[model samples]
Target: MASKQQTVASFVETAPPGELSNVVADIKALAPSEAQALAPAYKKYNEEQYITVKLPDGNGTAILSPYNSLDNNRYFDTATETSFEVDHASQKTSNPQPHALETPHADLLRNLHKALTTTSSEHFPTSSHTITPTNTDPSTLTILLVATKFSPQNFWNARWRSTYTYNPSTTTLAGSVKVDVHYYEDGNVRMNTRKEFASREVSGGAEAVGREIAKLENKFQEDLNRGFGVLGEGCFKSLRRQLPVTRQRMEWEKFQGYRLGQDIGGGRAK
Candidate 1:
Protein backbone atom coordinates (compact mmCIF):
# COMPACT_ATOMS: atom_id res chain seq x y z
CA MET A 1 0.00 0.00 0.00
CA ALA A 2 1.12 3.53 -0.73
CA SER A 3 2.37 5.57 2.23
CA LYS A 4 0.21 8.53 3.42
CA GLN A 5 2.60 11.05 1.84
CA GLN A 6 2.61 9.16 -1.46
CA THR A 7 -1.19 8.94 -1.43
CA VAL A 8 -1.52 12.69 -0.85
CA ALA A 9 1.09 13.27 -3.56
CA SER A 10 -0.92 11.29 -6.08
CA PHE A 11 -4.03 13.31 -5.34
CA VAL A 12 -2.08 16.53 -5.60
CA GLU A 13 -0.81 15.39 -8.99
CA THR A 14 -4.31 14.93 -10.46
CA ALA A 15 -6.23 17.77 -8.78
CA PRO A 16 -5.88 21.47 -9.55
CA PRO A 17 -2.76 23.13 -8.25
CA GLY A 18 -2.99 24.73 -4.77
CA GLU A 19 -5.79 22.34 -3.77
CA LEU A 20 -3.85 19.41 -2.39
CA SER A 21 -5.61 19.48 0.98
CA ASN A 22 -9.02 19.46 -0.66
CA VAL A 23 -8.07 16.43 -2.74
CA VAL A 24 -6.66 14.63 0.24
CA ALA A 25 -9.84 15.21 2.23
CA ASP A 26 -11.88 13.71 -0.58
CA ILE A 27 -9.62 10.72 -0.85
CA LYS A 28 -9.60 10.13 2.88
CA ALA A 29 -13.39 10.45 3.19
CA LEU A 30 -13.13 12.15 6.54
CA ALA A 31 -16.16 12.20 8.79
CA PRO A 32 -17.94 15.52 9.27
CA SER A 33 -16.30 16.11 12.64
CA GLU A 34 -12.95 15.09 11.22
CA ALA A 35 -13.40 17.37 8.19
CA GLN A 36 -13.89 20.26 10.61
CA ALA A 37 -10.33 19.76 11.75
CA LEU A 38 -8.98 20.57 8.27
CA ALA A 39 -11.09 23.68 7.75
CA PRO A 40 -8.74 26.16 9.41
CA ALA A 41 -5.64 24.93 7.65
CA TYR A 42 -7.21 25.18 4.17
CA LYS A 43 -9.63 28.08 4.47
CA LYS A 44 -8.71 29.76 1.20
CA TYR A 45 -8.85 26.78 -1.12
CA ASN A 46 -10.44 27.61 -4.50
CA GLU A 47 -11.36 24.10 -5.50
CA GLU A 48 -15.03 25.00 -5.41
CA GLN A 49 -14.71 28.56 -6.69
CA TYR A 50 -15.53 29.50 -10.28
CA ILE A 51 -14.85 32.48 -12.53
CA THR A 52 -16.97 32.89 -15.72
CA VAL A 53 -15.90 35.51 -18.23
CA LYS A 54 -18.57 37.10 -20.45
CA LEU A 55 -16.64 37.34 -23.71
CA PRO A 56 -17.49 40.34 -25.87
CA ASP A 57 -17.78 38.06 -28.90
CA GLY A 58 -20.86 36.15 -27.53
CA ASN A 59 -18.94 33.07 -26.48
CA GLY A 60 -18.09 32.60 -22.82
CA THR A 61 -16.57 30.02 -20.52
CA ALA A 62 -17.63 28.81 -16.96
CA ILE A 63 -14.98 26.79 -15.20
CA LEU A 64 -15.59 25.89 -11.57
CA SER A 65 -17.19 23.55 -9.03
CA PRO A 66 -20.19 21.23 -9.32
CA TYR A 67 -23.53 22.85 -8.53
CA ASN A 68 -25.65 21.58 -5.63
CA SER A 69 -29.18 22.11 -6.96
CA LEU A 70 -30.71 19.78 -9.55
CA ASP A 71 -33.68 19.93 -12.01
CA ASN A 72 -36.17 18.70 -9.41
CA ASN A 73 -35.64 21.79 -7.27
CA ARG A 74 -34.58 24.68 -9.53
CA TYR A 75 -35.42 25.95 -13.06
CA PHE A 76 -33.34 25.50 -16.19
CA ASP A 77 -33.50 25.81 -19.98
CA THR A 78 -31.27 23.13 -21.40
CA ALA A 79 -31.83 24.12 -25.00
CA THR A 80 -30.24 27.50 -24.35
CA GLU A 81 -27.93 26.21 -21.61
CA THR A 82 -29.21 28.73 -19.04
CA SER A 83 -30.49 28.15 -15.49
CA PHE A 84 -32.41 29.95 -12.74
CA GLU A 85 -31.71 29.44 -9.05
CA VAL A 86 -34.50 31.58 -7.57
CA ASP A 87 -37.62 31.82 -9.67
CA HIS A 88 -39.31 33.86 -6.91
CA ALA A 89 -40.95 36.16 -9.49
CA SER A 90 -40.43 33.94 -12.46
CA GLN A 91 -42.27 34.83 -15.65
CA LYS A 92 -43.17 31.13 -15.68
CA THR A 93 -44.99 31.22 -12.34
CA SER A 94 -48.61 30.09 -12.48
CA ASN A 95 -49.83 32.88 -10.19
CA PRO A 96 -47.20 35.47 -10.89
CA GLN A 97 -46.94 38.02 -8.07
CA PRO A 98 -45.97 41.64 -8.48
CA HIS A 99 -43.88 43.21 -5.72
CA ALA A 100 -43.09 46.88 -5.26
CA LEU A 101 -41.61 49.45 -2.95
CA GLU A 102 -43.84 50.13 0.06
CA THR A 103 -45.94 53.25 0.78
CA PRO A 104 -44.19 56.62 1.01
CA HIS A 105 -42.93 55.35 -2.33
CA ALA A 106 -40.44 58.07 -3.02
CA ASP A 107 -38.45 57.43 0.13
CA LEU A 108 -38.50 53.69 -0.51
CA LEU A 109 -37.42 54.05 -4.10
CA ARG A 110 -34.59 56.38 -3.15
CA ASN A 111 -33.38 53.92 -0.53
CA LEU A 112 -33.64 50.98 -2.93
CA HIS A 113 -31.75 52.90 -5.59
CA LYS A 114 -29.00 53.63 -3.16
CA ALA A 115 -28.90 50.02 -2.04
CA LEU A 116 -28.71 48.64 -5.58
CA THR A 117 -25.86 50.91 -6.52
CA THR A 118 -23.89 50.48 -3.32
CA THR A 119 -24.19 46.76 -2.56
CA SER A 120 -24.33 45.20 -6.03
CA SER A 121 -21.06 44.27 -7.74
CA GLU A 122 -20.25 43.15 -11.29
CA HIS A 123 -19.36 39.73 -12.71
CA PHE A 124 -15.62 40.05 -12.55
CA PRO A 125 -14.03 40.76 -9.17
CA THR A 126 -12.58 44.04 -10.45
CA SER A 127 -15.70 45.60 -12.09
CA SER A 128 -19.07 46.93 -10.80
CA HIS A 129 -22.66 47.77 -11.80
CA THR A 130 -23.55 51.10 -13.51
CA ILE A 131 -26.58 53.35 -13.12
CA THR A 132 -27.76 55.92 -15.69
CA PRO A 133 -30.38 58.61 -15.07
CA THR A 134 -31.42 61.58 -17.25
CA ASN A 135 -33.31 64.50 -15.74
CA THR A 136 -33.07 66.82 -18.74
CA ASP A 137 -33.89 64.06 -21.24
CA PRO A 138 -37.30 63.41 -19.56
CA SER A 139 -36.72 59.63 -19.35
CA THR A 140 -36.95 57.25 -16.42
CA LEU A 141 -33.89 56.30 -14.41
CA THR A 142 -32.17 52.98 -15.19
CA ILE A 143 -30.78 50.83 -12.38
CA LEU A 144 -28.77 47.68 -12.96
CA LEU A 145 -28.46 45.08 -10.21
CA VAL A 146 -25.82 42.38 -10.12
CA ALA A 147 -26.23 39.38 -7.85
CA THR A 148 -23.65 36.74 -7.01
CA LYS A 149 -23.20 33.46 -5.13
CA PHE A 150 -19.98 32.19 -3.62
CA SER A 151 -19.51 28.90 -1.78
CA PRO A 152 -16.28 28.54 0.15
CA GLN A 153 -16.52 24.86 0.96
CA ASN A 154 -17.01 24.16 -2.71
CA PHE A 155 -15.00 27.23 -3.76
CA TRP A 156 -17.53 28.46 -6.35
CA ASN A 157 -18.88 31.81 -7.51
CA ALA A 158 -21.73 32.80 -9.85
CA ARG A 159 -23.31 35.92 -11.42
CA TRP A 160 -26.93 36.78 -12.30
CA ARG A 161 -28.76 39.92 -13.53
CA SER A 162 -31.86 41.95 -12.73
CA THR A 163 -33.23 45.41 -13.57
CA TYR A 164 -35.78 47.74 -12.00
CA THR A 165 -37.63 50.83 -13.26
CA TYR A 166 -39.07 52.54 -10.19
CA ASN A 167 -41.37 54.95 -12.01
CA PRO A 168 -43.07 52.12 -13.86
CA SER A 169 -42.82 49.70 -10.89
CA THR A 170 -41.27 47.10 -13.16
CA THR A 171 -38.66 44.46 -12.48
CA THR A 172 -36.99 42.18 -15.01
CA LEU A 173 -34.51 39.51 -13.98
CA ALA A 174 -32.87 36.58 -15.81
CA GLY A 175 -30.18 34.11 -14.82
CA SER A 176 -26.94 32.91 -16.56
CA VAL A 177 -23.89 30.61 -16.20
CA LYS A 178 -20.74 29.57 -18.12
CA VAL A 179 -19.34 26.25 -19.34
CA ASP A 180 -15.93 25.09 -20.65
CA VAL A 181 -16.67 21.37 -20.87
CA HIS A 182 -18.06 19.54 -23.91
CA TYR A 183 -21.80 19.90 -24.39
CA TYR A 184 -24.13 20.89 -27.22
CA GLU A 185 -26.00 24.15 -26.89
CA ASP A 186 -29.08 24.67 -29.03
CA GLY A 187 -28.16 28.37 -28.88
CA ASN A 188 -26.20 30.89 -26.86
CA VAL A 189 -27.60 32.96 -23.99
CA ARG A 190 -27.48 36.53 -25.22
CA MET A 191 -26.45 39.00 -22.49
CA ASN A 192 -25.17 42.55 -22.05
CA THR A 193 -22.39 43.39 -19.62
CA ARG A 194 -19.45 45.70 -20.15
CA LYS A 195 -20.52 44.61 -23.65
CA GLU A 196 -23.31 42.60 -25.29
CA PHE A 197 -22.49 38.92 -25.80
CA ALA A 198 -23.72 35.29 -25.88
CA SER A 199 -22.70 31.74 -24.91
CA ARG A 200 -20.90 29.27 -27.18
CA GLU A 201 -22.89 26.24 -28.36
CA VAL A 202 -22.13 22.52 -28.11
CA SER A 203 -24.21 19.34 -28.55
CA GLY A 204 -24.95 16.66 -25.98
CA GLY A 205 -27.95 14.86 -24.44
CA ALA A 206 -29.35 15.25 -20.90
CA GLU A 207 -27.10 12.70 -19.21
CA ALA A 208 -23.99 14.29 -20.65
CA VAL A 209 -24.91 17.99 -20.36
CA GLY A 210 -27.17 17.86 -17.30
CA ARG A 211 -24.52 18.53 -14.63
CA GLU A 212 -23.05 21.55 -16.37
CA ILE A 213 -26.47 23.20 -16.64
CA ALA A 214 -27.26 22.32 -13.03
CA LYS A 215 -24.02 23.77 -11.62
CA LEU A 216 -24.44 26.92 -13.69
CA GLU A 217 -27.95 27.32 -12.32
CA ASN A 218 -26.57 26.78 -8.85
CA LYS A 219 -24.17 29.66 -9.33
CA PHE A 220 -26.88 31.84 -10.79
CA GLN A 221 -28.99 31.31 -7.67
CA GLU A 222 -26.09 32.06 -5.36
CA ASP A 223 -25.34 35.32 -7.16
CA LEU A 224 -29.01 36.25 -7.31
CA ASN A 225 -29.41 35.91 -3.53
CA ARG A 226 -26.60 38.43 -2.93
CA GLY A 227 -28.90 41.20 -4.12
CA PHE A 228 -32.23 42.54 -2.63
CA GLY A 229 -30.94 42.87 0.90
CA VAL A 230 -29.85 46.52 0.74
CA LEU A 231 -33.39 47.89 0.62
CA GLY A 232 -33.91 47.11 4.30
CA GLU A 233 -36.69 45.08 5.94
CA GLY A 234 -40.16 44.94 4.39
CA CYS A 235 -38.84 46.85 1.36
CA PHE A 236 -40.43 44.58 -1.27
CA LYS A 237 -43.71 43.84 0.49
CA SER A 238 -46.63 43.42 -1.95
CA LEU A 239 -49.73 45.61 -1.81
CA ARG A 240 -53.13 44.32 -0.76
CA ARG A 241 -56.33 45.81 0.69
CA GLN A 242 -58.53 44.65 3.53
CA LEU A 243 -62.00 43.62 2.40
CA PRO A 244 -65.23 44.23 4.35
CA VAL A 245 -64.87 41.39 6.87
CA THR A 246 -68.54 40.76 7.65
CA ARG A 247 -68.55 41.90 11.33
CA GLN A 248 -67.27 38.57 12.66
CA ARG A 249 -64.06 38.32 10.63
CA MET A 250 -63.40 41.99 11.31
CA GLU A 251 -63.40 41.38 15.04
CA TRP A 252 -61.18 38.33 14.56
CA GLU A 253 -58.61 40.14 12.40
CA LYS A 254 -58.51 43.00 14.86
CA PHE A 255 -58.12 40.66 17.79
CA GLN A 256 -55.53 38.70 15.81
CA GLY A 257 -53.55 41.86 15.17
CA TYR A 258 -53.68 42.72 18.86
CA ARG A 259 -52.59 39.20 19.75
CA LEU A 260 -49.78 39.40 17.27
CA GLY A 261 -48.58 42.62 18.86
CA GLN A 262 -48.82 41.01 22.24
CA ASP A 263 -46.86 38.03 21.03
CA ILE A 264 -44.24 40.30 19.52
CA GLY A 265 -43.82 42.66 22.49
CA GLY A 266 -46.54 41.87 25.02
CA GLY A 267 -48.69 44.48 23.25
CA ARG A 268 -46.13 47.10 24.34
CA ALA A 269 -47.37 46.80 27.91
CA LYS A 270 -45.07 48.85 30.09
Candidate 2:
Protein backbone atom coordinates (compact mmCIF):
# COMPACT_ATOMS: atom_id res chain seq x y z
CA MET A 1 0.00 0.00 0.00
CA ALA A 2 2.82 2.41 0.90
CA SER A 3 4.42 1.73 -2.42
CA LYS A 4 1.13 2.18 -4.19
CA GLN A 5 0.71 5.69 -2.66
CA GLN A 6 2.32 7.08 -5.75
CA THR A 7 2.70 10.82 -6.20
CA VAL A 8 -0.66 12.60 -6.42
CA ALA A 9 -0.71 16.29 -7.35
CA SER A 10 -3.48 18.94 -6.56
CA PHE A 11 -3.41 22.45 -8.00
CA VAL A 12 -4.99 24.02 -4.84
CA GLU A 13 -6.53 23.13 -1.51
CA THR A 14 -10.39 23.33 -1.26
CA ALA A 15 -12.39 24.39 1.83
CA PRO A 16 -14.65 21.78 3.39
CA PRO A 17 -18.04 21.56 1.68
CA GLY A 18 -20.48 24.18 3.03
CA GLU A 19 -17.83 25.80 5.21
CA LEU A 20 -18.65 29.45 4.00
CA SER A 21 -22.11 28.68 2.63
CA ASN A 22 -23.83 30.54 5.51
CA VAL A 23 -21.80 33.70 4.89
CA VAL A 24 -22.69 33.61 1.17
CA ALA A 25 -26.34 33.12 2.05
CA ASP A 26 -26.22 36.10 4.48
CA ILE A 27 -24.76 38.42 1.81
CA LYS A 28 -27.39 37.38 -0.68
CA ALA A 29 -30.11 37.91 1.89
CA LEU A 30 -28.85 41.45 2.79
CA ALA A 31 -28.98 42.71 -0.83
CA PRO A 32 -32.81 42.95 -0.98
CA SER A 33 -33.08 44.79 2.37
CA GLU A 34 -30.38 47.22 1.34
CA ALA A 35 -32.16 47.92 -1.88
CA GLN A 36 -35.47 48.38 -0.04
CA ALA A 37 -33.92 50.84 2.42
CA LEU A 38 -32.41 52.89 -0.40
CA ALA A 39 -35.72 52.94 -2.30
CA PRO A 40 -37.63 54.98 0.27
CA ALA A 41 -34.72 57.38 0.69
CA TYR A 42 -34.53 57.94 -3.07
CA LYS A 43 -38.28 58.51 -3.26
CA LYS A 44 -38.17 61.01 -0.43
CA TYR A 45 -35.22 62.90 -2.00
CA ASN A 46 -36.87 63.13 -5.43
CA GLU A 47 -40.24 64.21 -4.02
CA GLU A 48 -39.07 67.82 -3.63
CA GLN A 49 -37.77 68.26 -7.19
CA TYR A 50 -39.20 68.89 -10.66
CA ILE A 51 -39.15 66.03 -13.14
CA THR A 52 -39.94 65.49 -16.81
CA VAL A 53 -42.66 62.86 -17.14
CA LYS A 54 -42.18 60.96 -20.40
CA LEU A 55 -44.91 59.29 -22.39
CA PRO A 56 -44.61 56.04 -24.29
CA ASP A 57 -44.43 57.97 -27.53
CA GLY A 58 -41.40 59.92 -26.20
CA ASN A 59 -43.32 63.16 -25.65
CA GLY A 60 -42.69 64.57 -22.18
CA THR A 61 -44.09 67.16 -19.79
CA ALA A 62 -42.51 68.95 -16.88
CA ILE A 63 -44.02 67.96 -13.51
CA LEU A 64 -43.33 69.24 -10.05
CA SER A 65 -42.55 66.69 -7.35
CA PRO A 66 -45.28 66.01 -4.78
CA TYR A 67 -43.32 67.61 -1.95
CA ASN A 68 -42.64 70.79 -3.98
CA SER A 69 -46.32 71.19 -4.94
CA LEU A 70 -45.59 73.76 -7.71
CA ASP A 71 -47.28 74.03 -11.16
CA ASN A 72 -44.27 72.98 -13.24
CA ASN A 73 -46.14 71.48 -16.23
CA ARG A 74 -46.38 73.50 -19.44
CA TYR A 75 -48.20 72.31 -22.56
CA PHE A 76 -48.35 73.85 -26.05
CA ASP A 77 -51.07 73.39 -28.62
CA THR A 78 -51.07 74.24 -32.32
CA ALA A 79 -53.14 77.41 -31.87
CA THR A 80 -50.93 78.50 -29.04
CA GLU A 81 -47.67 77.44 -30.66
CA THR A 82 -44.73 79.66 -31.51
CA SER A 83 -46.38 80.76 -34.74
CA PHE A 84 -49.09 82.50 -32.76
CA GLU A 85 -46.72 84.70 -30.89
CA VAL A 86 -48.04 88.23 -30.50
CA ASP A 87 -46.17 91.42 -29.89
CA HIS A 88 -48.13 93.17 -27.22
CA ALA A 89 -46.35 96.46 -27.65
CA SER A 90 -46.92 96.59 -31.39
CA GLN A 91 -50.35 94.91 -31.35
CA LYS A 92 -49.18 92.63 -34.13
CA THR A 93 -49.37 88.93 -34.82
CA SER A 94 -47.34 86.65 -37.08
CA ASN A 95 -48.73 84.72 -40.02
CA PRO A 96 -47.45 82.25 -42.56
CA GLN A 97 -45.44 83.65 -45.46
CA PRO A 98 -47.29 84.56 -48.62
CA HIS A 99 -46.60 83.12 -52.08
CA ALA A 100 -44.66 85.15 -54.66
CA LEU A 101 -46.22 86.57 -57.83
CA GLU A 102 -46.33 83.71 -60.32
CA THR A 103 -48.43 84.81 -63.31
CA PRO A 104 -49.07 88.05 -65.24
CA HIS A 105 -51.57 88.89 -68.03
CA ALA A 106 -49.06 91.00 -69.91
CA ASP A 107 -46.71 88.04 -70.18
CA LEU A 108 -49.57 85.86 -71.40
CA LEU A 109 -50.57 88.42 -74.02
CA ARG A 110 -47.00 88.57 -75.27
CA ASN A 111 -46.77 84.79 -75.54
CA LEU A 112 -50.10 84.57 -77.39
CA HIS A 113 -48.92 87.23 -79.82
CA LYS A 114 -45.65 85.45 -80.41
CA ALA A 115 -47.39 82.12 -80.99
CA LEU A 116 -49.98 83.59 -83.37
CA THR A 117 -47.42 85.49 -85.41
CA THR A 118 -44.86 82.70 -85.78
CA THR A 119 -46.86 79.46 -85.90
CA SER A 120 -49.55 80.77 -88.26
CA SER A 121 -46.79 81.18 -90.88
CA GLU A 122 -47.63 84.85 -91.10
CA HIS A 123 -45.22 87.71 -90.66
CA PHE A 124 -45.78 89.52 -87.40
CA PRO A 125 -49.24 90.36 -88.58
CA THR A 126 -50.81 90.86 -85.16
CA SER A 127 -50.04 93.98 -83.18
CA SER A 128 -50.61 94.60 -79.46
CA HIS A 129 -50.62 97.84 -77.55
CA THR A 130 -50.91 98.48 -73.82
CA ILE A 131 -53.54 100.78 -72.33
CA THR A 132 -52.66 102.12 -68.92
CA PRO A 133 -55.25 102.10 -66.18
CA THR A 134 -56.90 105.49 -65.86
CA ASN A 135 -57.53 104.86 -62.19
CA THR A 136 -54.74 104.68 -59.65
CA ASP A 137 -55.87 101.14 -58.93
CA PRO A 138 -53.46 98.69 -60.54
CA SER A 139 -56.28 96.17 -60.85
CA THR A 140 -58.06 98.30 -63.38
CA LEU A 141 -55.78 97.81 -66.37
CA THR A 142 -57.10 97.66 -69.95
CA ILE A 143 -55.55 96.73 -73.29
CA LEU A 144 -56.78 97.96 -76.67
CA LEU A 145 -55.57 96.85 -80.07
CA VAL A 146 -56.86 95.83 -83.50
CA ALA A 147 -56.89 92.14 -84.33
CA THR A 148 -55.13 90.72 -87.40
CA LYS A 149 -56.83 91.01 -90.81
CA PHE A 150 -57.17 88.00 -93.07
CA SER A 151 -57.93 89.82 -96.35
CA PRO A 152 -57.07 93.13 -97.98
CA GLN A 153 -60.80 93.86 -98.34
CA ASN A 154 -61.14 94.03 -94.54
CA PHE A 155 -59.83 97.57 -94.80
CA TRP A 156 -63.14 98.88 -96.30
CA ASN A 157 -65.67 96.42 -94.84
CA ALA A 158 -64.47 95.96 -91.26
CA ARG A 159 -66.49 96.71 -88.10
CA TRP A 160 -64.94 96.21 -84.69
CA ARG A 161 -66.40 95.54 -81.20
CA SER A 162 -64.78 94.91 -77.82
CA THR A 163 -66.29 93.56 -74.56
CA TYR A 164 -64.61 92.43 -71.37
CA THR A 165 -65.20 91.76 -67.64
CA TYR A 166 -62.68 92.39 -64.91
CA ASN A 167 -62.84 90.63 -61.57
CA PRO A 168 -60.71 91.77 -58.66
CA SER A 169 -61.16 88.56 -56.71
CA THR A 170 -59.68 85.75 -58.80
CA THR A 171 -57.48 87.58 -61.30
CA THR A 172 -58.82 85.46 -64.16
CA LEU A 173 -58.93 86.60 -67.81
CA ALA A 174 -61.05 85.10 -70.58
CA GLY A 175 -62.54 86.36 -73.87
CA SER A 176 -63.39 85.41 -77.44
CA VAL A 177 -62.90 86.79 -80.97
CA LYS A 178 -65.41 86.61 -83.83
CA VAL A 179 -64.58 87.76 -87.35
CA ASP A 180 -66.71 88.09 -90.52
CA VAL A 181 -65.23 88.23 -94.01
CA HIS A 182 -66.64 89.81 -97.20
CA TYR A 183 -64.99 89.67 -100.61
CA TYR A 184 -65.56 91.92 -103.61
CA GLU A 185 -65.52 90.76 -107.26
CA ASP A 186 -62.33 92.73 -107.90
CA GLY A 187 -59.95 90.54 -105.86
CA ASN A 188 -60.62 92.50 -102.63
CA VAL A 189 -61.79 91.36 -99.19
CA ARG A 190 -63.17 92.93 -96.01
CA MET A 191 -63.39 91.84 -92.32
CA ASN A 192 -66.03 92.54 -89.69
CA THR A 193 -64.53 91.83 -86.30
CA ARG A 194 -66.14 91.42 -82.86
CA LYS A 195 -64.83 90.17 -79.55
CA GLU A 196 -66.82 87.95 -77.18
CA PHE A 197 -67.53 89.10 -73.65
CA ALA A 198 -65.74 87.26 -70.85
CA SER A 199 -64.49 87.77 -67.31
CA ARG A 200 -62.96 86.05 -64.26
CA GLU A 201 -62.96 86.54 -60.48
CA VAL A 202 -59.58 86.50 -58.77
CA SER A 203 -60.18 83.95 -55.99
CA GLY A 204 -57.35 84.92 -53.67
CA GLY A 205 -58.45 88.57 -53.24
CA ALA A 206 -56.74 91.81 -54.30
CA GLU A 207 -53.37 90.98 -52.80
CA ALA A 208 -53.32 87.79 -54.83
CA VAL A 209 -54.21 89.44 -58.15
CA GLY A 210 -50.64 89.91 -59.25
CA ARG A 211 -49.84 86.27 -58.60
CA GLU A 212 -52.99 85.14 -60.35
CA ILE A 213 -52.13 87.32 -63.29
CA ALA A 214 -48.80 85.54 -63.49
CA LYS A 215 -50.50 82.16 -63.49
CA LEU A 216 -52.98 83.23 -66.11
CA GLU A 217 -50.15 84.58 -68.18
CA ASN A 218 -48.47 81.17 -68.12
CA LYS A 219 -51.74 79.52 -69.07
CA PHE A 220 -52.12 82.07 -71.82
CA GLN A 221 -48.95 80.77 -73.45
CA GLU A 222 -50.31 77.22 -73.35
CA ASP A 223 -53.58 78.41 -74.84
CA LEU A 224 -51.75 80.27 -77.57
CA ASN A 225 -49.79 77.15 -78.44
CA ARG A 226 -52.97 75.14 -78.77
CA GLY A 227 -54.80 77.89 -80.62
CA PHE A 228 -51.94 78.38 -83.09
CA GLY A 229 -51.79 74.66 -83.80
CA VAL A 230 -55.44 74.61 -84.82
CA LEU A 231 -55.22 77.87 -86.73
CA GLY A 232 -52.15 76.64 -88.60
CA GLU A 233 -53.96 73.47 -89.69
CA GLY A 234 -56.96 75.42 -90.97
CA CYS A 235 -54.77 77.93 -92.80
CA PHE A 236 -52.77 75.11 -94.36
CA LYS A 237 -55.97 73.52 -95.61
CA SER A 238 -57.11 76.78 -97.24
CA LEU A 239 -53.71 77.33 -98.83
CA ARG A 240 -53.88 73.84 -100.36
CA ARG A 241 -57.14 74.72 -102.15
CA GLN A 242 -55.44 77.63 -104.02
CA LEU A 243 -58.58 79.72 -103.58
CA PRO A 244 -58.35 83.52 -103.63
CA VAL A 245 -56.10 84.06 -100.61
CA THR A 246 -58.28 87.16 -100.13
CA ARG A 247 -60.22 86.24 -96.99
CA GLN A 248 -57.19 84.98 -95.10
CA ARG A 249 -55.24 88.04 -96.07
CA MET A 250 -58.14 90.22 -95.00
CA GLU A 251 -58.32 88.68 -91.59
CA TRP A 252 -54.59 89.16 -91.17
CA GLU A 253 -55.05 92.74 -92.21
CA LYS A 254 -57.76 93.25 -89.59
CA PHE A 255 -55.28 92.32 -86.92
CA GLN A 256 -53.05 95.00 -88.37
CA GLY A 257 -55.81 97.59 -88.26
CA TYR A 258 -55.08 100.81 -86.38
CA ARG A 259 -51.46 99.70 -86.12
CA LEU A 260 -50.39 99.41 -89.72
CA GLY A 261 -51.88 102.26 -91.73
CA GLN A 262 -54.15 105.27 -91.48
CA ASP A 263 -55.66 104.42 -94.88
CA ILE A 264 -55.52 101.36 -97.20
CA GLY A 265 -52.54 102.25 -99.42
CA GLY A 266 -51.20 104.88 -97.00
CA GLY A 267 -50.21 102.39 -94.31
CA ARG A 268 -46.66 101.15 -93.73
CA ALA A 269 -45.88 98.05 -95.81
CA LYS A 270 -45.46 94.84 -93.79
Give the Å error, residue 128, model 2.
Answer: 2.2
Which stretches of candidate 1 lie above 4 Å from their native place? 1-109, 114-131, 134-138, 152-155, 168-270
Q: TM-score for all predictions?
A: 0.19, 0.24
lDDT score for candidate 1 against the true structure: 0.33
The digit string of per-residue lDDT tens for model 1 on 12-31 reads 44443223445666755744
Best by TM-score: 2
Candidate 2: regions farther than 4 A off: 1-124, 134-139, 150-165, 174-180, 186-195, 201-270
Give the alpha carbon lDDT tens digit for every residue of 143-241 in model 2: 322233334333232212222233333556454433344455555444334434456665543334334433544454466568658867887566764
Model 1 RMSD vs true structure = 23.6
Q: What overall lDDT goes with each candidate model?
A: 0.33, 0.33
